[model samples]
Target: MDKLLSNIKIEVPPGIYLKDPESSSLGKKIVENSIILLENIGFEDFNFKKLGQLIGSNESSIYRYFESKHKLLIYLTSWYWSWIEYQLVLETYSINDTKDKLIKAIEIVSRTTKQDSKYSHINEVLLNQIVINENSKSYLTKDVDIENKDGSFMPYKRVVQRISEIISAYNTSYKYPLTLASSVIESALHQQFVKIHFKSITNCNDEITPTEFFIDLTLKTLTDGK
Candidate 1:
């Protein structure tokens, strides 16, 4: 997640940088420029100073908008999820049934995943943090009051819940609950990518894209051996 977001430039100069309560145009520019930089230099070599310099802004000015690198990382992760939600909403316009919705949803996610090169680093970082780092798992899954006092869940949990809702709409005859299927989907989505990251020796030259395989397999499973 951090790596994917590392492409975004949050702080810019007084004249060129984004101000607090960022205007949409300025914010979009910051994200676009940041992605260009990240693609060239990678995240480890990128930072506010480098970004600020590239965008004709001062480091201090950048800090004013994002505060710290940590805040910037959180913002990026949330932005990815928000974007997914928005795309799903848009795709729903063409989907009238659960089966179609599930298939469309998978296709949309797969397309977005492939096109967003920024997410490569983000996916790599998230997999490492969630599966390898004990402390990060706790933070990622820490309970929060999303709807009611008694109904609390973590950030990832909510994401999973949304995924489950989409899954549930598929073939009602299938006995397995959408929640369980969602967990399977999430595990497959995140962990498999990380595994591929290593198995390909970090070159990312795999032939069969996860999107294709996942979409086909998930549809079959959800459709009761279809």
Candidate 2:
């Protein structure tokens, strides 16, 4: 697991970004600093102009890597999915029992993320915050069809499919594996939003962790037992 995470260099879809942000010194700075920018200011206020100033580079240099802030957001989100998927596979791939695999898969998505130094260019903490608060904006937009057609969402979808396959292995007779998989994925993200914004309604706290909530719900939903 340590070896695999240490070797991470996730490849984003070609159409997702203008250039690979991990390719050069300037590009790496763009990826590293942009996460900071997005974290400090909300996505609505984030743009290449501000990012360029922050990185001590010009707008054209930043634009050379990303066409727009939307694309940049998509790229960042996709990179995150790819990285987490790597961790997911590393942690769960070797398990022979389907139930164990399914449980481990749920754990990967439900826990709060800690930044891995293997990918120094990306700050996992800020990326997770963006995912909870801003990532839906990338796909919830009107241009979703165009981006989907371009395969920009493939990394995230791949994560869903892997988990869905685990469900099918757990219970071939059960239906709605893919739907359940997507639900767990989206719900895990939204639960963070709920915990932060709707604390009065949520029971998530130090006693009942986000991970415990999802593991209980997912196992019961998958096996029809608590």
The lDDT for every candidate, in the order shown, is: 0.50, 0.87
CA shift at 81, candidate 2, in angstroms?
0.5
Q: Output the number of the TM-score-best candidate.
A: 2
**Which stretch of 10 consecutive residues in model 2 shows the poorest summed lDDT?**
217-226
Q: Which model scores highest in lDDT?
A: 2
Clashes of each: 5, 0
Model 1 bad stretches (over 4 Å): 1-21, 24-28, 112-159, 171-207, 223-226
Work out how many backbone clashes candidate 1 has: 5
Q: Model 2 reaches what TM-score against the true structure?
A: 0.95
Q: In candidate 2, which residue pairs get closer than 3 Å at backbone N, Cα or C atoms, i.e. clash?
A: none
Which residue pairs in candidate 1 have backbone atoms (N, alpha carbon, C) closer than 3 angstroms, thus clashing?
A: 1-122, 4-122, 7-34, 11-62, 13-57
